[model samples]
Target: MAATPNIYGILAEFETPADAMHAAEKVRDTGFRKWDVFTPYPVHGMDKAMGLKNSKVGWFSFIGGVTGYTSGMVMIWWMNAVDYPIPIGGKPMFSPFGAFPPCYELTILLGAFGALFGMLFMNRLPRLHHPLLKHRRFALATHDRYFIVIETTDPKYSENETRKLLESVGSKRIELVEE
Candidate 1:
Protein backbone atom coordinates (compact mmCIF):
# COMPACT_ATOMS: atom_id res chain seq x y z
CA MET A 1 0.00 0.00 0.00
CA ALA A 2 2.86 2.33 0.72
CA ALA A 3 4.87 1.79 -2.42
CA THR A 4 3.04 3.45 -5.23
CA PRO A 5 3.66 0.98 -8.05
CA ASN A 6 5.82 -2.06 -8.40
CA ILE A 7 8.28 -0.53 -10.81
CA TYR A 8 10.01 -3.62 -12.05
CA GLY A 9 11.19 -2.41 -15.46
CA ILE A 10 14.24 -0.22 -16.08
CA LEU A 11 15.55 3.28 -15.62
CA ALA A 12 17.74 5.35 -17.85
CA GLU A 13 19.41 8.59 -16.86
CA PHE A 14 20.43 11.39 -19.14
CA GLU A 15 22.99 14.13 -18.84
CA THR A 16 20.67 16.68 -20.43
CA PRO A 17 17.01 17.33 -20.99
CA ALA A 18 17.51 16.99 -24.73
CA ASP A 19 18.77 13.48 -24.33
CA ALA A 20 15.93 12.63 -21.99
CA MET A 21 13.44 14.06 -24.42
CA HIS A 22 14.90 12.16 -27.30
CA ALA A 23 14.96 8.89 -25.42
CA ALA A 24 11.41 9.34 -24.15
CA GLU A 25 10.02 9.94 -27.62
CA LYS A 26 11.83 7.00 -29.09
CA VAL A 27 10.68 4.79 -26.24
CA ARG A 28 7.12 5.89 -26.76
CA ASP A 29 7.43 5.28 -30.48
CA THR A 30 8.24 1.70 -29.65
CA GLY A 31 4.91 1.48 -27.77
CA PHE A 32 5.96 1.73 -24.15
CA ARG A 33 3.10 2.94 -21.95
CA LYS A 34 4.38 2.67 -18.40
CA TRP A 35 7.04 5.29 -18.57
CA ASP A 36 7.67 8.73 -17.03
CA VAL A 37 10.44 11.27 -17.13
CA PHE A 38 11.86 13.43 -14.37
CA THR A 39 13.49 16.75 -14.82
CA PRO A 40 14.94 19.38 -12.55
CA TYR A 41 13.36 22.20 -14.43
CA PRO A 42 10.62 22.60 -16.98
CA VAL A 43 12.05 21.81 -20.36
CA HIS A 44 10.60 23.79 -23.21
CA GLY A 45 8.47 21.65 -25.53
CA MET A 46 8.99 18.63 -23.36
CA ASP A 47 5.30 17.85 -23.33
CA LYS A 48 5.00 17.58 -27.09
CA ALA A 49 8.22 15.71 -27.36
CA MET A 50 6.98 13.13 -24.88
CA GLY A 51 3.53 12.85 -26.43
CA LEU A 52 1.78 14.03 -23.28
CA LYS A 53 -1.78 15.25 -23.12
CA ASN A 54 -2.70 18.69 -21.83
CA SER A 55 -3.46 18.65 -18.13
CA LYS A 56 -7.13 18.44 -17.11
CA VAL A 57 -6.41 20.38 -13.92
CA GLY A 58 -7.49 23.57 -15.65
CA TRP A 59 -11.07 22.30 -15.82
CA PHE A 60 -11.02 21.51 -12.15
CA SER A 61 -9.64 24.93 -11.32
CA PHE A 62 -12.34 26.57 -13.41
CA ILE A 63 -15.09 24.70 -11.63
CA GLY A 64 -13.55 25.43 -8.25
CA GLY A 65 -13.25 29.13 -9.02
CA VAL A 66 -16.89 29.28 -10.06
CA THR A 67 -17.91 27.42 -6.94
CA GLY A 68 -15.88 29.74 -4.73
CA TYR A 69 -17.30 32.81 -6.38
CA THR A 70 -20.82 31.53 -6.01
CA SER A 71 -20.24 30.54 -2.42
CA GLY A 72 -18.78 33.86 -1.42
CA MET A 73 -21.41 35.90 -3.21
CA VAL A 74 -24.28 33.86 -1.86
CA MET A 75 -22.94 33.85 1.66
CA ILE A 76 -22.42 37.60 1.70
CA TRP A 77 -25.73 38.34 0.04
CA TRP A 78 -27.69 36.13 2.39
CA MET A 79 -25.99 37.46 5.51
CA ASN A 80 -26.44 41.10 4.61
CA ALA A 81 -29.76 41.09 2.72
CA VAL A 82 -31.87 38.18 3.83
CA ASP A 83 -30.42 36.37 6.82
CA TYR A 84 -29.98 39.26 9.23
CA PRO A 85 -31.34 42.19 7.25
CA ILE A 86 -28.65 44.48 8.64
CA PRO A 87 -28.64 48.06 7.37
CA ILE A 88 -25.24 49.68 7.66
CA GLY A 89 -24.21 53.18 6.48
CA GLY A 90 -27.40 53.34 4.37
CA LYS A 91 -25.77 51.00 1.87
CA PRO A 92 -27.85 48.48 -0.04
CA MET A 93 -28.61 45.30 1.81
CA PHE A 94 -26.73 43.29 -0.78
CA SER A 95 -23.57 45.10 -1.78
CA PRO A 96 -22.35 43.26 -4.83
CA PHE A 97 -19.33 45.52 -5.00
CA GLY A 98 -18.39 44.75 -1.43
CA ALA A 99 -18.47 41.05 -2.23
CA PHE A 100 -15.94 41.44 -4.98
CA PRO A 101 -12.81 41.30 -2.83
CA PRO A 102 -13.87 38.25 -0.86
CA CYS A 103 -15.18 36.59 -3.98
CA TYR A 104 -11.89 37.15 -5.77
CA GLU A 105 -9.90 35.83 -2.85
CA LEU A 106 -12.13 32.80 -2.59
CA THR A 107 -11.81 32.12 -6.26
CA ILE A 108 -8.03 32.12 -6.05
CA LEU A 109 -8.09 29.90 -2.98
CA LEU A 110 -10.45 27.43 -4.58
CA GLY A 111 -8.56 27.46 -7.83
CA ALA A 112 -5.31 26.67 -6.05
CA PHE A 113 -6.93 23.95 -4.01
CA GLY A 114 -8.49 22.44 -7.09
CA ALA A 115 -5.23 22.49 -8.96
CA LEU A 116 -3.36 20.84 -6.10
CA PHE A 117 -5.94 18.15 -5.56
CA GLY A 118 -6.39 17.61 -9.26
CA MET A 119 -2.66 17.06 -9.68
CA LEU A 120 -2.56 14.65 -6.80
CA PHE A 121 -5.46 12.70 -8.17
CA MET A 122 -4.17 12.74 -11.71
CA ASN A 123 -0.72 11.63 -10.60
CA ARG A 124 -1.84 9.19 -7.89
CA LEU A 125 0.37 10.95 -5.41
CA PRO A 126 0.79 10.88 -1.61
CA ARG A 127 2.18 7.37 -1.76
CA LEU A 128 5.11 6.59 0.46
CA HIS A 129 7.55 5.45 -2.22
CA HIS A 130 8.43 5.18 -5.90
CA PRO A 131 10.76 3.03 -7.94
CA LEU A 132 12.96 5.93 -8.95
CA LEU A 133 13.61 6.80 -5.33
CA LYS A 134 15.41 3.52 -4.88
CA HIS A 135 17.99 4.25 -7.50
CA ARG A 136 21.18 5.50 -5.85
CA ARG A 137 21.87 7.96 -8.59
CA PHE A 138 18.29 9.12 -8.86
CA ALA A 139 19.02 11.60 -6.10
CA LEU A 140 21.02 13.49 -8.64
CA ALA A 141 17.93 13.89 -10.76
CA THR A 142 16.65 16.71 -8.64
CA HIS A 143 20.03 18.32 -8.71
CA ASP A 144 21.28 18.00 -12.29
CA ARG A 145 20.08 14.85 -14.01
CA TYR A 146 17.17 14.04 -16.25
CA PHE A 147 15.75 10.55 -15.94
CA ILE A 148 13.19 8.28 -17.59
CA VAL A 149 11.44 5.46 -15.83
CA ILE A 150 10.08 2.49 -17.74
CA GLU A 151 7.87 0.38 -15.52
CA THR A 152 7.21 -3.33 -15.58
CA THR A 153 3.54 -2.87 -16.46
CA ASP A 154 4.37 -2.10 -20.05
CA PRO A 155 3.86 -5.07 -22.32
CA LYS A 156 7.08 -4.25 -24.14
CA TYR A 157 9.05 -4.14 -20.89
CA SER A 158 11.49 -6.86 -20.11
CA GLU A 159 14.83 -6.62 -18.43
CA ASN A 160 16.79 -7.54 -21.52
CA GLU A 161 14.48 -5.95 -24.05
CA THR A 162 14.12 -2.75 -22.06
CA ARG A 163 17.86 -2.51 -21.67
CA LYS A 164 18.34 -2.96 -25.36
CA LEU A 165 15.61 -0.43 -26.03
CA LEU A 166 17.24 2.20 -23.83
CA GLU A 167 20.62 1.50 -25.27
CA SER A 168 19.17 1.75 -28.76
CA VAL A 169 17.54 5.10 -27.89
CA GLY A 170 20.89 6.62 -26.99
CA SER A 171 20.62 6.60 -23.23
CA LYS A 172 23.69 8.17 -21.70
CA ARG A 173 23.80 5.90 -18.68
CA ILE A 174 21.25 3.20 -17.88
CA GLU A 175 20.52 2.10 -14.35
CA LEU A 176 17.84 -0.01 -12.80
CA VAL A 177 15.69 2.31 -10.65
CA GLU A 178 14.34 0.07 -7.90
CA GLU A 179 11.61 0.33 -5.31
Candidate 2:
Protein backbone atom coordinates (compact mmCIF):
# COMPACT_ATOMS: atom_id res chain seq x y z
CA MET A 1 0.00 0.00 0.00
CA ALA A 2 1.14 3.52 -0.76
CA ALA A 3 1.36 6.13 1.95
CA THR A 4 -0.80 9.20 1.58
CA PRO A 5 1.00 12.55 1.68
CA ASN A 6 -0.16 13.80 5.03
CA ILE A 7 -1.42 17.28 5.83
CA TYR A 8 -0.44 17.03 9.42
CA GLY A 9 -2.53 18.78 12.09
CA ILE A 10 -3.04 18.39 15.80
CA LEU A 11 -6.42 18.65 17.44
CA ALA A 12 -6.70 19.25 21.15
CA GLU A 13 -10.08 18.98 22.78
CA PHE A 14 -11.07 20.89 25.92
CA GLU A 15 -13.95 20.54 28.29
CA THR A 16 -14.59 24.27 28.29
CA PRO A 17 -13.74 27.29 26.18
CA ALA A 18 -11.99 28.71 29.21
CA ASP A 19 -9.65 25.75 29.31
CA ALA A 20 -9.19 26.02 25.58
CA MET A 21 -8.39 29.70 26.02
CA HIS A 22 -5.77 29.02 28.66
CA ALA A 23 -4.19 26.44 26.41
CA ALA A 24 -4.34 28.86 23.52
CA GLU A 25 -2.52 31.49 25.58
CA LYS A 26 0.19 29.01 26.42
CA VAL A 27 0.52 28.00 22.80
CA ARG A 28 0.48 31.54 21.53
CA ASP A 29 3.10 32.60 24.03
CA THR A 30 5.23 29.77 22.74
CA GLY A 31 5.15 31.66 19.43
CA PHE A 32 3.38 28.93 17.51
CA ARG A 33 1.73 29.90 14.23
CA LYS A 34 -0.63 27.96 11.94
CA TRP A 35 -3.04 27.28 14.76
CA ASP A 36 -6.77 27.91 15.17
CA VAL A 37 -9.43 27.42 17.82
CA PHE A 38 -12.93 26.09 17.28
CA THR A 39 -15.75 26.81 19.68
CA PRO A 40 -19.50 26.58 19.73
CA TYR A 41 -19.61 30.28 20.44
CA PRO A 42 -17.25 33.22 20.49
CA VAL A 43 -15.13 33.26 23.63
CA HIS A 44 -14.26 36.61 25.14
CA GLY A 45 -10.52 37.21 25.46
CA MET A 46 -9.95 34.41 22.97
CA ASP A 47 -8.66 36.83 20.36
CA LYS A 48 -6.07 38.12 22.78
CA ALA A 49 -5.03 34.58 23.69
CA MET A 50 -4.76 33.74 20.00
CA GLY A 51 -2.63 36.84 19.49
CA LEU A 52 -4.81 38.24 16.72
CA LYS A 53 -4.10 41.77 15.60
CA ASN A 54 -6.52 44.41 14.40
CA SER A 55 -8.02 43.52 11.04
CA LYS A 56 -7.14 45.75 8.05
CA VAL A 57 -10.42 44.93 6.32
CA GLY A 58 -11.64 48.43 7.13
CA TRP A 59 -8.69 49.93 5.30
CA PHE A 60 -9.62 48.00 2.16
CA SER A 61 -13.21 49.19 2.61
CA PHE A 62 -12.04 52.77 2.98
CA ILE A 63 -10.01 52.61 -0.22
CA GLY A 64 -12.88 51.07 -2.08
CA GLY A 65 -15.23 53.76 -0.77
CA VAL A 66 -12.85 56.44 -1.96
CA THR A 67 -12.55 54.80 -5.35
CA GLY A 68 -16.29 54.49 -5.76
CA TYR A 69 -16.86 58.10 -4.73
CA THR A 70 -14.19 59.27 -7.14
CA SER A 71 -15.62 57.12 -9.92
CA GLY A 72 -19.11 58.47 -9.38
CA MET A 73 -17.93 62.05 -9.34
CA VAL A 74 -15.77 61.59 -12.41
CA MET A 75 -18.61 59.90 -14.28
CA ILE A 76 -20.97 62.73 -13.43
CA TRP A 77 -18.33 65.30 -14.32
CA TRP A 78 -17.63 63.73 -17.69
CA MET A 79 -21.28 63.23 -18.58
CA ASN A 80 -22.47 66.69 -17.47
CA ALA A 81 -19.52 68.86 -18.46
CA VAL A 82 -17.28 67.09 -21.00
CA ASP A 83 -18.77 64.07 -22.75
CA TYR A 84 -22.09 64.74 -24.51
CA PRO A 85 -22.81 67.61 -22.17
CA ILE A 86 -26.50 68.07 -21.45
CA PRO A 87 -28.63 70.14 -19.07
CA ILE A 88 -30.92 68.24 -16.64
CA GLY A 89 -34.40 69.83 -16.41
CA GLY A 90 -32.83 73.31 -16.61
CA LYS A 91 -30.38 72.35 -13.85
CA PRO A 92 -26.73 73.48 -13.97
CA MET A 93 -24.32 71.35 -15.96
CA PHE A 94 -21.82 69.44 -13.77
CA SER A 95 -23.92 69.81 -10.66
CA PRO A 96 -21.72 67.95 -8.22
CA PHE A 97 -24.02 68.83 -5.31
CA GLY A 98 -26.88 66.88 -6.86
CA ALA A 99 -24.72 63.75 -7.20
CA PHE A 100 -23.91 63.55 -3.49
CA PRO A 101 -26.56 61.04 -2.31
CA PRO A 102 -26.02 58.44 -5.04
CA CYS A 103 -22.27 58.85 -4.85
CA TYR A 104 -22.29 58.38 -1.09
CA GLU A 105 -24.54 55.30 -1.37
CA LEU A 106 -22.26 53.79 -3.98
CA THR A 107 -19.33 54.53 -1.75
CA ILE A 108 -20.98 52.58 1.07
CA LEU A 109 -21.84 49.73 -1.29
CA LEU A 110 -18.28 49.47 -2.54
CA GLY A 111 -16.90 49.76 0.94
CA ALA A 112 -19.07 46.87 2.23
CA PHE A 113 -18.20 44.69 -0.74
CA GLY A 114 -14.52 45.40 -0.33
CA ALA A 115 -14.60 44.56 3.36
CA LEU A 116 -16.46 41.29 2.88
CA PHE A 117 -14.43 40.06 -0.07
CA GLY A 118 -11.14 41.24 1.37
CA MET A 119 -11.69 39.28 4.61
CA LEU A 120 -12.70 36.08 2.82
CA PHE A 121 -9.81 36.33 0.40
CA MET A 122 -7.26 37.18 3.06
CA ASN A 123 -8.40 34.43 5.42
CA ARG A 124 -8.55 31.82 2.63
CA LEU A 125 -12.00 30.86 3.89
CA PRO A 126 -14.20 28.05 2.57
CA ARG A 127 -11.34 25.72 3.31
CA LEU A 128 -12.82 22.50 2.00
CA HIS A 129 -9.67 20.42 2.13
CA HIS A 130 -8.28 20.92 5.58
CA PRO A 131 -6.55 17.98 7.27
CA LEU A 132 -8.81 18.41 10.29
CA LEU A 133 -11.70 17.23 8.15
CA LYS A 134 -10.36 13.73 8.52
CA HIS A 135 -10.73 13.87 12.27
CA ARG A 136 -14.01 12.28 13.36
CA ARG A 137 -14.20 14.35 16.52
CA PHE A 138 -14.09 17.74 14.81
CA ALA A 139 -17.81 17.66 14.08
CA LEU A 140 -18.50 18.66 17.66
CA ALA A 141 -17.10 22.10 16.86
CA THR A 142 -20.50 23.42 15.89
CA HIS A 143 -22.09 21.90 18.94
CA ASP A 144 -20.82 22.47 22.48
CA ARG A 145 -17.22 21.38 22.01
CA TYR A 146 -14.05 23.43 21.91
CA PHE A 147 -10.86 22.52 20.13
CA ILE A 148 -7.48 23.91 19.15
CA VAL A 149 -5.57 22.72 16.14
CA ILE A 150 -2.00 23.33 15.05
CA GLU A 151 -0.52 22.54 11.67
CA THR A 152 2.56 20.40 11.28
CA THR A 153 4.22 22.97 9.03
CA ASP A 154 5.57 24.61 12.16
CA PRO A 155 9.30 23.99 12.64
CA LYS A 156 8.81 22.74 16.18
CA TYR A 157 6.23 20.05 15.42
CA SER A 158 6.99 16.41 15.99
CA GLU A 159 4.61 13.51 16.51
CA ASN A 160 5.46 12.64 20.10
CA GLU A 161 6.44 16.16 21.05
CA THR A 162 3.22 17.65 19.71
CA ARG A 163 1.20 15.14 21.67
CA LYS A 164 3.21 15.92 24.74
CA LEU A 165 2.74 19.63 24.29
CA LEU A 166 -1.02 19.40 24.01
CA GLU A 167 -1.06 17.12 27.02
CA SER A 168 1.06 19.54 28.99
CA VAL A 169 -1.55 22.22 28.38
CA GLY A 170 -4.29 19.98 29.84
CA SER A 171 -6.03 18.92 26.67
CA LYS A 172 -8.46 16.14 27.53
CA ARG A 173 -8.38 14.55 24.12
CA ILE A 174 -5.53 14.84 21.60
CA GLU A 175 -5.55 13.76 17.99
CA LEU A 176 -3.12 13.89 15.13
CA VAL A 177 -5.39 14.59 12.18
CA GLU A 178 -3.98 13.96 8.71
CA GLU A 179 -5.06 14.93 5.24
Question: In model 1, where is the ten-residue run with the lowest total lDDT?
Answer: 1-10
| lDDT against the true structure, each candidate | 0.84, 0.87
- Residue 80 in candidate 2, Cα distance off native in Å: 1.4
Worst 10 residues of 2 by lDDT: 126-135
The alpha-carbon RMSD values of the candidates against the true structure, listed in the order shown, are 3.9, 1.7
Off by over 4 Å in 1: 1-7
Error of 2 at 38 (Å): 0.7
lDDT of 1 by residue, 1-179 (tens): 57664546577888888888888889878887778888998999888878888899998899989999999999999888988997889989988798899999999999999999988988899999865677788898789988888887788888898898888878878876544
Q: State residue 9's C-alpha deviation in candidate 2, in Å.
A: 0.8
**Against the true structure, candidate 1 has what lDDT?**
0.84
TM-score of each predicted structure versus truth? 0.85, 0.92
As a TM-score, model 1 comes out at: 0.85
Full-model lDDT, candidate 2: 0.87
